[model samples]
Target: MDKKSPSDTAEFNISAYDQAEFNDLLFENMPDYAFVKNDSFKIVKANSAFLSMYPTNIRDKVIGYTTVEDYQPKEAELFLARDKEAFEQGYSETVETITFPDHRIRTLLTRKKRFEAIDGRTYILGIATDVTEREELIEKLRKSNDDLDQFAYMASHDLKAPLTAIAKLVSWIDEDHRSELPVGAIENFELIKSRINRMTQLLNDMLTYSRVNQTPHEKEEFSFKDLVLEQFDMICIDKEFNLSCCELIVSLQKDAIAIVLRNLLANAIKHHHLDHGNIDVTIEEKKGFYLIKVTDDGPGIDPQYSSKIFEMFQTLKPRDQQEGSGIGLAICKKIANHYAGDITLIDQPNGTSFLVTWPSVPTQQPPFKRIK
Candidate 1:
């Protein structure tokens, strides 16, 4: 007190300001709307974010006023009710659409908590995070998916009629005019028929790919071995190729899993160069997913094409050389994604091994440890 140095005085002032304005600094700088209301719901304090909702000249008018005085009556009523609930229950949180003083409607994730100040006064602290853009994006995505589904339905329906008529006409030409045509012409007609057949398969696969997960299906318990056997029975496999699965019970969408297994089995058999090859189907239960490994003793895929294999209409072999729609792997990937899972080609020494990581029951757990 006798002779306080200038630096000591400056330090004292800085410490005092910090102690008094620490909360104010945090509240004013916060990105979200933050405010404090007294027990009677009168706004006692509001941060810059909250004040920004009003005009600059009249921003000070927001303090000491209730939400009813600042916002639309209807919106204010909802806010007051939620505030009252928070006061009674100690806390409340909700995602609500609110109209600001500037008349802008915004979606907000609001949290209200009953708080007590150092003065022993009861208050409510409200913080709201604007989520309008996020919610709007989600809604747009939902609408886009709906539009795509409708387009796919109409396009498939419209295209199939013309495709069927053309197929019938080609068949009639082959049956009724084969003898009258020259040998070269006959081969040409056969080629035309083969092309038509390929077109038909492509259309069918396209339809299947588009319709996947369009409707929700209930999950049910089924034996893994039984599902593999059932799907294998539907497909015509070479006698020398063996398809086997271990015994395990799983709960899943039976029809969806069946479709996945059907595609994988079909792919393995169709791509195999050798007549006698082994197709082994095995399942391993991991931390949070079921690893379905489909190993084949066939000409393995090039590692370069592994990522591209799952893309729609992507194929490693030429369409002319291999009779395939090139949509099987894509459909498998889609189905896996629908269940929050994934399908990938695991590199192997002698042949291709596909790993389907099907999410375990209650598919909300962390991702499974990826196999290297």
Candidate 2:
């Protein structure tokens, strides 16, 4: 056979050379810290990103050594345990906060997996992505929301006491001067009382909205019919309204569900053109969600206003014409979205229909019995 020429040798090595060069450039230039450790847990290889993280004095000794001596005892133990888990289980992942040689702290999403090289030796490949800025942003946003909720709660509570006193004063004046005052004066006082009551209701709703998501919504077993009737009775004291609902037992967050039902029922009754109207509520389990349909024979919401109804303090009609804080549907939407569900308006020819999708979870307890 003829000896291979120099050109043939270069051509044979071209593909391998390109591949090796690409991998080397990627490992050295990548932003995330990357390292490889042997079964003995000694770091045998590390990228430029990893070496730059250590102090200048220790950088040269990092290879062929364990980092336990450079880290705290507890941190060393944790790192060793993670390495063992990766080797045994094939992979491991965790979020850890570490301080760099420059004294800068960083939160990292660390991933480690067992990788077997052509040398027939077992090794662990590790990668750590810095998430320090993301974590700080999340913490700041959480604190801001908590402060806003607290402010709303305190303001509403403080204002209610003075409002209550004003209402009482108006009541006393009417009782004491009704006989001596003109009919117009009596009407004026009545209007003042109504306004005071409206303000009080608005404040109460604001307080409820602020605390809507403060508590965890734990699932509970209860009669769906009973819950509807209970909330309806509270709102419809003297009003003539017919509520037809399905008789089903449901397992869900009881208080959160109550708020949804109460708001829907109140909207129907309050917006009805007549003294008596028909309201129907039915719920069915749909795969991963509970589909709740609340339909009422009242003036349906205009298509234009449908989108605005669920927003906080958004109402189609003026507050004077319709007495509401406009936070009812907002509360419902917030609670629904928290569970990865939604509330939507289904357009109908005459009546309004609210479709509330509540995410369903496996019942943790026995089924509740429906009351007759």
Candidate 3:
């Protein structure tokens, strides 16, 4: 037996497709509304499911003869135009709602491909997948988000009233009872004062978190370098730390971007392990993604609890140890998610680094922008 040459093998492989038992496989597992149309956009072939969807009269008349306009609703002209454009552009997949003769509507996401038959006939092969269930699920998720936003608004607003009263009472007790207070009584007062302070801080942070999604953004193009520099200056002046690596890089959205960087820097400095710790900030551009990393030479996080750091109200250390509201990282996570970005903590043998990856420019406006 002689082995086939490269050229001969190529020809034989092409012919092998014709003899392959695929025709039975094709019709056996055919889609519900599988169809083909000629260059004129006339129906050339439709599967059994397509025929079952229409009345006998319309089906018979429509077979081998019908334009998109003949069956599509008038309001759906734009959709048909898009399909036609896809057909002209050498093929496209379109999801359109078609009204059956029974007056029931069905969504058909038809993928059109330009192909030439053996007889040199140009046709558009369209395969449709039913997406009604997926669309319904999406709508349900949308409604769930709307409900969640409303609950957050209500919950935050309701919490502020009681918080304000507690703060006011704390101030009143400090002013009126300081002179008459016993030795240990003043310490109790201080405890109340500290509790009120923590409550106030927690509420304010919660309000900010809830409002991030609810608030509309003014995304004018601004330099990210300027934003980081301004934040670095403020942090340096306030706290004594070794943050020498001040690399200036340009980024968009002045205030929103500022919010993200502020929380990250705050966390770095607040959680420093050493008296004079190191904080390194790096900005890298990679394949349409902005990679911003904030590294601290502090005591690294435990491997077990690294995942829970960004969760709301989750803290590894007690309030006395870090004196944190525990909402900073949660807010950072929210801001990152607003721009379709993500935040992760990488635990090294030496220290911990918080890595944030955000798009240079968001692909779409944050979904909450449209809601009032």
Give the TM-score comparing model 3 with the true structure, all chains together. 0.80
Kindly provide the TM-score of model 1 when superposed on the true structure, using C-alpha atoms: 0.85
Model 1 poorest 10 in a row by lDDT:
363-372
Error of 3 at 347 (Å): 2.0
Task: Write one digit per residue (lDDT tens) for candidate 1, span 136-223.
Answer: 9999999998788778767877888998998898789878987888899888878887887887888788888889887776789889
**Local distance difference test, per candidate?**
0.85, 0.87, 0.73
Which pairs clash (backbone N, Cα, C closer than 3 Å) in model 2? none
* lDDT (10s digit) by residue, model 3, range 1-372: 988789987765544567554653574367657777776767777777766667666677666775444455663475456557656776676666777655677776666677788989778766676777877788899999878767776787788798789878877887987788797988987887787778777877877887776666666665566666678777755567766444545555557777878887777777776556778877787887778888878788887887798999988888866677788888888888887788988877877788888887667753222111
Give the better candidate number (1 or 3) by TM-score.
Answer: 1
Worst 10 residues of 3 by lDDT: 363-372
lDDT for model 2, please. Answer: 0.87
Among all candidates shown, the one with the greatest lDDT = 2
TM of each candidate vs. truth = 0.85, 0.84, 0.80
Clashing pairs in 1: none
For model 3, the stretches where C-alpha displacement exceeds 4 angstroms are 1-28, 55-58, 67-72, 75-79, 114-122, 181-185, 213-225, 235-238, 246-248, 361-372
Per-candidate Cα RMSD to the true structure, in Å, reads 7.0, 8.8, 6.1
Q: Residue 255's C-alpha lDDT in candidate 2?
A: 91
Residue 131 alpha-carbon offset, candidate 1, angstroms? 2.4
